[model samples]
Target chain A: MKFFINKENLLFAIQSVQRAVSQKSPLPILTGIKFSCEEDKLVLSATDFEISVRCAVPATVEESGSLVIPARYITEFARRLPDSIIEFEAGPDSTMAVIRYGDSEFNINGYDASEFPSFVIPEEEFSFKLDADLFKEIIKQVTFAVSTEESRPVFTGVFFEIVAGRLTIVATDTFRLALRHTAINEETPELINVIVPGKTLNELARTADPKSIVEVIIGKTHAAFITGEIQIIARLIPGKFPSYRQVIPNQFISEIKIPLKDFLESAERVALLAGENNLLVSLYIRENHVVLNMRSETGWIREEIKSEVNGDKLEISFNVRYLCDVLRSINYEQLVVRFTGPLTPALIIPEDNKDYLSILVPARLSRE
Target chain B: MKFFINKENLLFAIQSVQRAVSQKSPLPILTGIKFSCEEDKLVLSATDFEISVRCAVPATVEESGSLVIPARYITEFARRLPDSIIEFEAGPDSTMAVIRYGDSEFNINGYDASEFPSFVIPEEEFSFKLDADLFKEIIKQVTFAVSTEESRPVFTGVFFEIVAGRLTIVATDTFRLALRHTAINEETPELINVIVPGKTLNELARTADPKSIVEVIIGKTHAAFITGEIQIIARLIPGKFPSYRQVIPNQFISEIKIPLKDFLESAERVALLAGENNLLVSLYIRENHVVLNMRSETGWIREEIKSEVNGDKLEISFNVRYLCDVLRSINYEQLVVRFTGPLTPALIIPEDNKDYLSILVPARLSRE
Candidate 1:
């Protein structure tokens, strides 16, 4: 393979696909990135049997061929190279590629191209398109609640469902749940559902451009997200997702509307005294104000933030980290929190945007 | 103890002394900071036996008392507090201090101040003063070469020797050595020599202000550095430091002058191909040009840089990391490297400065 590629373009392509490169695999070939050169573009692909990524960049090709280079060396070398035209060439019979720039050259040994596992998009049963910005927002709002415990594999993935031109995403870790609904461009009479690993959604959020449109294709055993010149295909996590709707309460005994920024600041300050082993912070809601209290072996702190509170006065205890996460994720100025009782789950939603809501299970307080 | 202090002032005092606070100590009092309220100021002190720090901040003292507060809690709380007057009070017999600000309050438990270790500056045999900026610069230029091996305890400290009106600092790990000389404001008939641990010098460098004057008092077993409102006392590393002057070569067979930036960049790039086990990069000097070459199991790369070379043509190899450290520490556009032979130590110094120089031992090549 022979091609003269711009340093920035090559680096971008490598970074986009190299996230899928296996760090330590039994098959050594999976640790490399496959590089293919055509008449007008250079393609890079990497996969670890879970998620596969492909990215194409414009290049001036002299000879068309393919090679698999070690991801570790090439990534570091590309970052340190000067921002000039890079000359790359490798004979069809040779497994080593020579990269030259200015007065320096690197001859990096690689595996045979035929040994690399090729990734081909499977036949899609359904496809839908959405704004890249909306897709990123949806992932950010719900992925944080995905369970990290691998024993329950179904909870480790985010659920995606499209029904009647509206798309809904949900993620839960048994203790808390997040749900977001947005209007999608595609209309499907039947329900389309898929469970994608949380890791895939995070990578997509990082690589997707907000100005472009993203097309999602769902296959029987895999799913693909295509945006501009990049495509990410991930294996579908096979399992039945828990029913998330039944956990969200529809009624409340207390509803408190507070300024998001002030509430977040107060919670953070109170959390300082909440010992790491037991991150419990109690919220006492009154007529027009709410107070946060936390006690640890070393100290106890109390912070008060004025807000509009309604319904019966009550006190609820929760893991302060869960409250902080929801406050930081939303951009609204005010938030409404609904509480049913001390033992029931509390629902929190942005005051201006009702489509996104999160539920947190109250912690059982051992002491008053 | 009762006092009202500015948030910024309290934070600065905490940060300055917190470096000496013990993370985990058998003596529980050492894990806390001693706060002493005087008529006009509040004094904060922390010690870990090896190093002690004291800083005084102006405060409105309502009463005179003392207590030991946990460093971990107070430091984090101080950073997050808003910029306002903080009210602090504790009964003479109570072990808990109540800190109040706005509508927030923190009641932190602590130990009696009587249990904390007291640090007292000893009588100095000799003392000298220098610009804090210059002291920081000298520490940075020499501390990088200090040995980290605990077996050789003497090499883990930087040597400080002041003779007449010149101060010279030297650090070496036996493999490489860095020496710097600068003029101080004080002159004494007898030389003052001491070795300070690298860890202490690094902390001193970080806390010293550029606009202040630092007075260094050398006691028999301890050294004290006083700058503005902060004072750091460190136990001197007792041992005879190895004589460093004999390793420097006065004459050389070849002298090469190269642009510092270009030489540094080339060395870093060539070092990428040098295996981590053997960081050997060979420099081939011929007339007015130098070539950097490295060969590893995976690849080999060579880079050429134009410069002003004199004397006999030769090739020498050295660990690129050692060369890069000296190049990065000095602020000079051009550097002159003197080489006696392929195996002899190479001397590198700023082309325009004579007060700073570094020597690197050549690495023996095992194969061609």
Candidate 2:
């Protein structure tokens, strides 16, 4: 294969596909990026069995051929090449590939392109285009709560549910759950439910441009996200996700409003004194003031912030890290803490918006 | 003990001393920072047996007392506290310390002050003052060559040799050596040779301001650096250092000048294709052009650049990483590579200065 392309354009395409390359794989071919020059474009594809990324760059195709080269070496070489056009040509016997840029030439050993696994791209059947910025925001607000533990594979992904014109994203790790609601511009369709791995979603969020619209196509076993000239296909986790709506508290006997930044700062301060593995938080409500206390045999910290309380004074304890994560993921100016008795899980939501809610299970406080 | 001080000032002092704190130490007291509050100053000190740092912050001390608090907790707390005046008060029994800032209060369990190790500062000793920026620059340039292997404890640090009117710093890892030369204003009757730990020097570099002047005091067993209100003392490694001067070649048969950035970029590009862990570089010099070839059974990369060569055509091979490090550390625009033969060690120096040189031993090339 022989082709000439801009260094930056080729580098970007290689990097976009490199995210799916696996360092530890049974097949050595999986460690390479397949490069094919056909017609008028150069195509780059990388996969690790579970997910695959393919991107095409405009190029002057001198001859149409294919070869698989080491992903990391090519990526680094392309990145360091001076701003100039890069040329690639297959060597004799197709055992080596030569890359030339400016006065520099890199001859890298190549793997048989026939050994590379082929991934089929799902046809654009039921597709929806959404604003990349808004989609990224929704993912950021809910992906952090996804469970990383692989024991329950279903919980390791975010549950996407679409009914009528509204779309909801929910993630739960048993200790805490995050739910975000949004509206889609597409017409009402049959209810759709799928669990997409949080890691793949995060990569998509990073690669997607905030200003561009991302086209998403869902299939039986995989989902495809097309942004600009890049396309990413991720396999759906096949399992049953827990019903998170049932766990959210529907009633609250006590509620308090506190500034978001103030609460976040105080939580971070108190968390420093807590143990590394687990952090305990004790909340005491008295009159119009709320006292947040965290203590360990190592140290103790107390923060008192004035809040608008509208119920009987109560005291509750929970994991401080869970509360902190929820507060940090939120972009609201003020947050409301709704409690349903001392032992029930508490709900945290933006004071002005009810579209997003975070539920934290309270810890059993020992009698002092 | 009771005192109040600006949060920013206290945080800075705590951060400086915390650099000496080690999480994994046999002595528990080494992990805690000793606080001594007297009259109008609060002193914070931390030591890891090998190195110690102490700094004093201006404060309104109500009474005089001292205690040891966990360094990590205090540093983290101070970093997160709001920008305001912080109040510090020790318990009547002196077993707990209270830190208050705005509406937040932290009560950290304290250790007995008597358990904290005491460090003595040398009086009426040899002292020299130098620009912090220049000292830091010299350290940055040579310290990267320090031996990380613990087999030779003395080689794990940089040797600082001070003569009548000059200061020379040298570091080597057996494979490569870097030397930096700088002039000192004061003349001394006695020559000084001290080997300071690379880790400690790195910490000192981080805390030292580039624009300020730093006072250096060399003692019998320890070296002290004073900058602003902070004093850092490091225990010298006592042993005979390798004769680095004898290893550097005094004469060479061939010398080539090349742009530092171009050489670095080309070396890095070829090195990426070299085998992991073992990076070998082969240089082929012609009448006016130099070609660098590096290949592993796994990959192959070759780059050619034009240069001005002074001797007959020569070929040499060496560890690519060593050359890359030296080229990266050079601050000059251009560098000259001087060598005796293909197997002999090569010297890399700034094109305009001969005082600073990096010597790299050649590596045996594998048969193709």
Q: DockQ (Cα-based) per candidate?
A: 0.65, 0.74
Candidate 1 residue spans exceeding 4 A from truth? A91-93, A210-212, B91-94, B274-276
Residues forming the 10-long window of minimal summed lDDT in candidate 1 chain A: A269-278
lDDT of 1: 0.89
Q: How well is each residue in B108-160 modelled by candidate 1, as lDDT tens digits? A: 99889987888788688888888899888888988888899989989999999
> What tier of docking accuracy does candidate 1 attain?
medium
> Model 1 reaches what TM-score against the true structure?
0.94
Interface RMSD of each: 1.6, 1.4
Off by over 4 Å in 2: A276-278, A366-368
Clashing pairs in 1: none
Local accuracy by lDDT, each model: 0.89, 0.86
B1-368: candidate 2 lDDT, tens digit per residue: 88888988888888888878878898887789998989889999998888899999888989889989888788878888898888888877886899887777889888888888897775535788899998788888988898999889988999989899889899999888999988899888888888998888888887798988989898878899999888999888899889887898988889898888788889988778666655889998777778898877766777888888888688888888888888787688888988888888989889999679898898877663
